[model samples]
Structure formats: structure tokens, C-alpha cells
Target: MVSSIAQFQIKPIGAELHLFGIDISFNNSALFMIIATILVSAFLTQSVKSSYTIPNRIQSLAEMTYEFTTKIVSENVGIEGMAYFPLIFSLFMFILAGNLLGILPYAYTFTSQIIVTFAISIAIFLGITVIAIIKHGTKFFRFFLPSGTPVYMAPLLIPIEILSYLSRPISLSVRLFANMVAGHTMMKVFGGFVISLGAAGFVPLLFLVALTAFEVLVAVLQAYVFTIITCIYLSDALYLH
Candidate 1:
């Protein structure tokens, strides 16, 4: 049986290249990421290319996604957050596309890699930190200690609060990476059973169908979770809450 983890391997394609000692050669992960980006771009552009009073399926889907993201930002980050709508929207769509693309046969799920997810999460975390510092100046550090906390509790509470704050990116990235890895691994296991068991594989084949459907739901849900949490973080930075 093929190793379940083999599907996640990062095999380089074509010629390899290095820039300043860093290996920047394109690989399966990079190729699928590009595919996801192109697919998202094409879908969004085609969905909105023509206007209609009674929108078609594609337009309706695009509109619904737009409204959903708008509401998320409005409710989580308030009016000031509207300025970053484009960034939030792009993040949501890109992640959603990447997750869905990974569901296809032989496609690499870039989001499944902890490094990729962590890099994205850390960048967002740093950006939010910078925004908060710029907006509130020295007051940004005040967030490490809640306003109503007792002075006597400062010694204990400060460290806990700081640890939690610093762990945000780790938690965020791990959540996505873990879910993708677990779901894909389970699917692979069941697929092997389907092939190996032959006629008796019907049981696993049935389960595989159900698992695939669930994975699709997970793909959409994870993207929303990631985006909404990002909105909440941005809100905290904007309001120092």
C-alpha cells in the first residue's frame, strides 16, 4: 500500500533553482497553489463579468460569498475594518480555493503544510501587532493586562496573558494543518481498503463517499473559521479590546 503520508510530499518539478542560497525551486505544492489562485481569479472574474437583475447561478454564488464576507467584517471589526475588506476577502477566497483544490485527485494541499499555514498566520499576527502599535502607541502594551485586573495579580496574569497572545499564530496554524492532515489521512486509508478488498470493498467505498462529502464541508468551514478569527484579531487591534 502506498504510504498515506506520501501524498503530502513536496517533489520538485522541472529544473531546480536557488537564489542567494535559498531553495526557491517550484514544487508540487507551489504548482497547486498557482492553480488555486488562477481558478479563484477566473471564477470571480467570470462570475461578475455581466450584471443581471436576476443573477445566474455563478453570479448568485459570487454575490452570496461577497455578502457573507462583508457581514463577517462588519460584525467583527466594525466600520473601521471596512478599509481592510479587500485584504480579508482575498484571504478568505484564496484559502477557500486552496482547500477545495486539495480535494481533487492528485492535487497537493498547500494549507495542509504547517509551515505554509504558520507563515500566513505569523504574517497576519505581525501585521495586526504593528497596526495596534501604530494606532495606540505605547498603549498597545496595555493589552497584556486587562484594565480591571488587580495590581496584586499583575505578576501572574501578565505572563499568562502574554503567552496566550504569543501563541495565537501557533494555534491558528496548527488548527488548519491538523484538520487537513487528519481528514486526508483518513481518506487515504479508506481508499486503500477499497482497492485491496475488491468486491468486499463496498463497505469502505461507502464510507469514502461520506468522508469526501464531509471533507468538502470541512474545507469551507475551515476557511470561514480562519477568516473570522482574523477579523476578530483585527478588531482587537483596532479597538485594543
Candidate 2:
């Protein structure tokens, strides 16, 4: 049986190439990311290509997802948030697709990598910060300290608030990375048991099946959690208090 951790390794697919000083060789993680992007693109685009008065399965699913994302943005960030709906929707679908695709046989789960999740989280964090700065100017810094506090409390409260704000990317990244890694690792361990036990593996096989369904739910839930938190951050940026 293949080692469970071996599945997460980033082995180059072909000739490894160096661009300047960076290692730019294509690998499994990159390949799976591309696949996820293509799949999401096709699903979103094709689902609405031929809109019928009474939507078909694909169209219905697409419309439902669109409406769901709209509601999320509206509730979390208000009507003005609709301007950012495309970004929010794309982020949700891409992460969801990546999580779901990783469940397939021999598929790589890039989201399991802390570096990958951290990178995405950092980008979102930076973008939100920029938006806040642009919209509120110097007042954006006030987010680190709540209003109505005493002047004497500034010394203690500012540092704590600053630390909390800086930890956003780390917390967001770790949450997704931890969940994906834990769920996938457990499934892999159980899968190994199923293989080794042969005929007696029926028990573990059943568990693996249930675990898989749970993972799927997790995949969707994590996507929602990540997106909603982003919306909340966006709301904070748009309206400081």
C-alpha cells in the first residue's frame, strides 16, 4: 500500500525547469489546480449558456449557486457587496471544486498544503486592506482599536487589536489547511485498513464510505465558511465600525 502522506507530495510531472532563481516546474498540485479551474469555469459557464424558462438540472444548479452567493453577499456585506459578487462567487466555487476534486482517486489535495492556503489567505487579506485604505483613507488604521475606549487604554488595547488583525491570514489559512489535512489523512488511514484487511475489510470499507460523504460535506462547508468570513472582512473594510 502507498504511504498515506505520499499522496500530498509535489512531484514534478516532466522536466524540471528553472525560471531565473525560482523552481517553475509543473507538478501535481499545479495540475490539479488547473483542473479545478477548468471544471469550475465549465460548470459556471455551460450551466447558463442556454437559459430556459424552466431550467434544466445544470441550469438549475447554476442558478441556485448564483442565488446562494448573492444572498451571502447581500446579507454579509449589504447591497453594495453585489459589486464584488463575481470575486466572491469565483472564490467559493474554486475552493469547493478543489476540495471535491481531491476526493477522486489519485487526485492531489492542494488545499491540504498550508503554503497554498496561506498564500490565498494573504492575498485576500492584502486586497481587503487595500480596499479599506482606499475607501476610508487614514481612518482604516482605526480598525485596530475600537471606538469609545479611554485614552489610557490605547497602549494596551492597540497592541492586542493589532495582533488580532495581523493574525487573520494565519488563522484563515490554518483553518482550511488543518481541516483538509485532517479529513484526508483520516480517510487515507481508513482506506489503507480496507486494503490490508481484504475480505475482513468490509467494516472499514463501510466507514470509508461514510467518511467520504462527511468529507464532501466538509468540503462544501469549508468553502462556505471561508467565503462568509471574507464577506465579513469586506463588510468591516467597507464600514469601519
Candidate 3:
């Protein structure tokens, strides 16, 4: 059991020196995030430097990523919001790489941690709020009052909108964190069964393999869902509908 737990747990890569009595631990998640950032930066740099009119492998990959995000933004947020392509693209790639990297053996899933997901969700929420307020000034508060809402119901509709708006971060963070943690935990449990039962555990092992593939798909899908919701939120800010 101890071995199984060890197999599933993430280990620290290094520790930061304490400053002002605040201890900061740097771990595998931090290492993987650095790796993910480097990978993204390198890929984009290489693709741009190549400048191949015919398109090579790296260029093809870069184009695909650009097209995917562009399509999503255009469809969901419209042309006016195209300026946000970089933010949406980076968010998708970062989460996608973090998720896919975590699926590797002995890798840490940062997205499974509530702290990371909450940080991301909170950032997105605040960014959209700032954009809306900057664009609309004090009038942005009018968003809480739905169009065509009866004047007498302003007392009721306002609170409902406020509650729904406040719930965004909670819902966004939980959806990603819960899915990643639950899927990885179940995979680890089944994998342990396969190891302990040895050759006789072929059935569980096969199921584990199937679950791994499914988890890979889930990781990609979750990243897409996260990015799409971001675009939707941006749309709400841009159009206020």
C-alpha cells in the first residue's frame, strides 16, 4: 500500500530559501510547468523562424493550434474580440500541455490541484470583469439588470445575477480539478490492482489501458472546455448580453 501511494504521489524537485519567514516549496508540478512553458515557447519560436511557405511539421502544428483557437474565438466571441486570441491560445496550450504531461508515468498533474485551477479561474474572472468595467464604466453594473426585465423585479433579478456571476470561479475551478483528480485516482487504483494481482490480473490491466486512453481524451476535452468558456465570458464582456 505504501508503494502504491508512493507511485501516485508527487515529489518535490527543490525548495526555495525562506524570505520573511515564508517557506516556499518547489515541486514536480513546478518543474513540469516550467517544462510546459519552455516547450510552448520553443515550438512557437521554431515555427516562426522556419518561414516555410510549403509548411513543415512544426509549422503545420502551429497553424493547427492557431486555427483551432481562432475558430473558437470567432464563433463564440466574434470578430471584435479577436484581439484576445493570444490569451485564449496560451490558456488552451498551457492547460493542454500540463494535462497531457501529467498523464505520463511518474508525472505530476498540476491541474488536479485546486490551488492551480482556482488561480486560473480567478484570473479569468477578474480579467473579464476588468475589461467590462473599463469598457462600460459605471454602466457595467447594468449587466446585473437583464434586458426586458420587469422594473418591479429589479430587486429579485439583481441578486440572482450577482450570485450567478460570483459562482463562475467556483464552478470553473471545481470542474477541472475534480475531473483531473478523480480520473487519475481511479487510474492509480486500477493500476495497483494490476500490479498486485500479477499475470492473473490481465483483465484489470486491460481496463487500465483503456482508461488511460480515455483519460488522455478527457484531458484534451477539458482544456477545450476551459478555453471555450473563457471565450464565452469574453463575449459577455464585449457585448454585455
Candidate 4:
């Protein structure tokens, strides 16, 4: 029987390449990331190109996603945040596509990797930090200090708030990675049981189908949650709340 944990292993898929002493080898995770990017680009492009006065299914989906992302930005960051809508929109669709793609049998789930998720989270975290610093100048430092902070608690409060702020990437990355890994690993174990148990495996098989549907919901929800967090971060940067 194949080990359920083996599914999460990262193995090279092609001849390895090294650039400036760095390993840039292609792998299943990379392939799926490329595929996700291509598919997302194609879907959005086609949806826009074929859009009509009376929208069809694809057009409607495309428009709804657009409007949904727009609302997230406008509500969170106000008009000032509209400038970042493209970034937020791309993030939502990319994550949504990655999650759904991994649900397919034998497809590599890029978002399941902690490195990928952490990279995204950190990039957003850093970008928003830069935005706050650039826009607010030295006033950005006031975030850690916060309004109404007591004078006697400066040392304790400052460190605690700074630590909490730094934990954002860790929480964001782990949440996505842990959910995808747990859900997929459970599904794989049940799948293996179906093969091993033969006729009696129908019980696990039914549960597996239900789990797949649930995972799909999780995929969309995770994307939405991530985007919402992003908008919230931007709002804090813009409003210093």
C-alpha cells in the first residue's frame, strides 16, 4: 500500500537546472503552478473577449468575480484602495484556481506547499508595510505604538504588538497549507482503503465523494478569506486602524 504522506513529497519532474548556483529544477508543483496561471489567464481573457450585452455563464462568472473583488477593496480600503484591486483580484483567482486544480486526481496542489503559501503571505505583508511607510512616512511606526497606548506599558505593549504583526505571514501560510494537506491526506487514505478493502470499501468511497465536494467549498472559501485578509491589511495601512 502506498503511504498517504508520500503524496506530499516534492520530487523532480525533469532535468534539473541550476542558475547562479541555485536549484531551479522543474517539478510537479511548478508544472501545476504554470498550468494554473495559464488556465486563469485563458479563462479571464476568453470571458472578456466573448462578453455580450446579455452575459452568458462564463461572462457572468467573470463579471461576478470582478465585482466581488472590487467590493472587497472598496469596502475595506475605501476609494484609496481601488488602486490595488488588480493585485487583490489576481490573488483571489490564482488561489481559487490552485485549490480547484489540486482537487483533480493526480494533480499537484501548489497551494498545499507551505513555501508557496508563505511566500505569497510574506510578499503581501511586506508590500503593505512598504505602502504604509511610503504613504505615512515615519507615522507608520505609530501603528505598533497605537493610539491611547499607556505610557507605563510601552515596553510590553510594543513588543507584543510587534510580535503579533510579524505573525501574520505564519498564520496565513500555515492555515492554507495545513487545510490543504490535511484534507488531501485524508482523502488519499480513504482512497487507498477503497482499493485494499475491495467490496467493503463502498463506505469509504461515499465519504470520499462527499469530502471532495466539501474540499471544493474550502477551496473557494480559502481564496475569499485570504483576499479579505489582504483587504483588511490594506485598510489598516490606509486608515491606520
Which numbered prediction scores highest in TM-score against the true structure?
Answer: 1
lDDT of 2 by residue, 22-55 (tens): 9999999999999999887898887887556889
**Candidate 3 minimal-lDDT segment of 10 residues:** 1-10
Displacement of residue 223 (Cα, Å) in model 3 is: 0.6
lDDT by residue (83-116, candidate 4, tens digit) is 9989999999999999999999999899999999
For model 2, what is the error of residue 237's alpha carbon versus the real structure, in angstroms, after optimal superposition?
Answer: 0.6
What lDDT does model 1 reach? 0.94
Question: Candidates' lDDT values, in order?
Answer: 0.94, 0.91, 0.88, 0.91
What is candidate 3's CA lDDT for residue 97?
Answer: 89
lDDT accuracy of residue 159 in candidate 3: 98
Cα-based RMSD of the predictions, in order?
A: 0.8, 1.2, 1.9, 1.1
Which parts of model 4 have CA positions greater than 4 angstroms off?
none
Which candidate number maximizes lDDT?
Answer: 1
Error of 3 at 116 (Å): 0.5
Model 3 has a clash total of 0
Give residue 177's lDDT in candidate 2 (0 to 100): 89
lDDT of each residue in 161-223, candidate 1, tens digit only: 999999999998999899999999999999999999999999999999999999999999999
Q: TM-score for all predictions?
A: 0.98, 0.96, 0.92, 0.96
Number of the candidate with higher lDDT, 1 or 3? 1
Which tens-of-lDDT digit does each residue in 153-193 have in candidate 3? 99999999999999998899999888898888888889888
Q: If ranked by TM-score, best first, what sequence of candidates would result?
A: 1, 4, 2, 3
